[model samples]
Target: MAASVGRGAPAAGPEAGGALWAEVWALLPGTEEGLTLALSGEVDDCVRPLLRRARGLLYGAEGRPGEEAAAAALRRLGDVLRDYSWEKLNAGPWREISKAWRQVYTYGCLFGALAEVAAGRPLAPAVRLCDMGLLMGASVLDNVLARLVRVLQQHLPREQRRGAAGLAAESVRTEPRPAPAVRPEDALPRLRCPSLEHFRDNYLIPQKPVVLEGIMDHWPCMRKWSVDYFCQVAGCRTVPVELGTRYTDEEWSQKLMTVGDFISQYIVNENSMGYLAQHQLFDQIPELKEDISIPDYCCLGEGEEEHITINAWFGPEGTISPLHQDPQQNFLAQVFGRKYIRLYSPQDSENLYPHESQILHNTSQVDVEDPDLVKFPNFRKAAFQSCILMPGQVLFIPVKYWHYVRSLDVSFSVSFWWS
Candidate 1:
């Protein structure tokens, strides 16, 4: 018979409304203290060897004995069930509780008669009966897992939820500001390509922003890592975050899966995010010393042209960079499509109504289109710099300059920084 319960079924009713836990409890001896201890300890010890084997098998590691594979998988599943029990005992945040319950609800049905049998007094016959078929039974495990994840995510802070929703929203209604003249002082110095001595003397010490468009033009990624190439070479590594509109739980799942896939599958995300900080890759590229790395598909090319990088492929309308500033001077290069950037200078801090704290002073309030002048009257006079970065164009953003970025189309970019 099928195992697993549906929500809204009265827990007090006969058969407990198909509840998996109810079935397990029904098969067990009375829930006495001695029985609880015996069951918990036996489950813990009996499952250890299986867990060890399963851990190695799941990751495709070598050296696990062939005979141990089934035991290992079973042990891992048992551990998951054990944790589910503990979760109920220690209820804290709704999300944490929901997650634990969800795991049990989805995977419990798959555990089959073993879940019921194990909860009961251990018998010789029960031991012999436990087999692979017990685990293969269809259960509501995956569905329950999905629902729980959604419930937990929906509990995010209202502001954060709003911000996340705006990720894919249509661009602001205000007309684009007129382009500013690119004065020589505003341009990054045209130093000889790779040496740090020149970059420091010209750009770093003085805090100048420069566009190094031609420098990395030859990097393999510059030409090959387009959306099509990414989907082909990397496969679903780019996430689809909601930059503008509210996302259903299903939409959020798609976004998260895509983001997680990108991070797990790509070397660029790993390397750029400092996962390989001590590896030979860093030794080969000196430009990365000052770049604050983010976990995304950022890469450094070989040869003297290696640049510290932060990159992401935005799908449809993707992650909109909330208005914030980084610590280091920036060299943001657009390699595909277009990205809109709005900038506010550090000198204009008073008019920008910077927060009192030194570290977070660069962050700006939302609702930029309509500011409450009574609270921050000076915001109206704040000087603004704006640009729409196109493929092969790089924009220099000095430290502490407030910036809000929007992907104009499916886009990708490489951003580098140096002290």
Candidate 2:
């Protein structure tokens, strides 16, 4: 009966088991020091016995512990595992919990391997348990850890949680020992609503980037598209949010949330940068489409004018769009904020070091602001034009021209794309 009980208990459903595993896994450590710290009373006492047994099983102990004690400890752990929800497990500092869990799983694997050697058995089932634990630990880090951190930041008081800016500051790479030399260049020219013939002859024909003023002054969005206005109009509408300071990082990802929640969490409160980028939000909210006009510049392209694609770009200050080129001519209209934009002509594509992958072919691998010039030495030769685009202005970006944009302040911009 004791053996049967030890071998089996009412198993939690997959969803519940996964949540429990994530919670426990989050409590483990990833390094030797973290493992030692976690085992030194950071985790629940009930978990200590199982961890001990895991160690013994892995290290080839003479025998299992007394049946009653082992069974009782197992029962206790099982109860906690089955009863706790993600909410309960995630109530504390998730980074600490995740580190602890990784440590526990690492030690558990070591213990399992040693026990297999000591027992002189064909294979011990406990080793499989250790393997599962290791996988769970990895899953916690790879999948849900960032989301958990975000949630913790949102709920906890400022003093309790490390600010997201501190985390971002840590990632800023120091300049290379000897910075690569780069040539200086002139700013992109600004023109005030030049005649369509002048625009076609001087800019479009030459395939040069230029900032056009007085183009967006007539758009309703220039006056009416404040954060509060968006919340009132599209608060409940769900939208895909880019969750990172920039898309260049591997840690960047996307999530879906109501526009109102996005405004409150990221725009108003100034949490970590969240972007409504490259999304055809106007298609989903036609009422919003009525507020802006596609610039006549798009019609200058060879493609049918009626087939223009519009994408919304809305984010807080410090948001960055890493150097990238589009397949179509782009008219980026600044509706309510200022943006620092740099443009590199397509002729410099060889120096840009575009990513090899087809999916990211349009995106440059090197960060424009702080390029690793040693690794991408040719980038030093890439001359560029730049401008600070203000509200009620439009920047005409010829198709395939490399552009990197950074918002100087809370900004909303729209891009009209055409062949």
Q: Write the per-residue lDDT of candidate 2 for residues 1-419, one digit (tens) a residue.
A: 22211112211233212333233334334332333323322555665666544433222231435433333334344334323322233567655555555444444433332233222222223323333333333332232322232222233343222222322322323222222232345677889989899999999898888889998888888778876567545554456789899997888998866565676667765657889885457755556888999887666778786688888998887899999998888899998767888899899999999999987999999888889999999999998988877788899999899999988777889999888
Per-model TM against the reference: 0.45, 0.56
* Model 2 regions more than 4 Å off: 1-185
Where model 1 places Cα greater than 4 Å from the true spot, the runs are 1-198, 236-255, 259-313, 317-319, 355-362, 366-375, 417-419
Best by TM-score: 2
RMSD of 2: 17.4
* Candidates' C-alpha lDDT: 0.40, 0.61
Per-residue lDDT tens digits of candidate 1, residues 139-222? 132222222222222332333323322322223122333433434433333432545565556655565544444555555555
Q: What is the C-alpha RMSD of each candidate to the true structure, in Å?
A: 16.6, 17.4
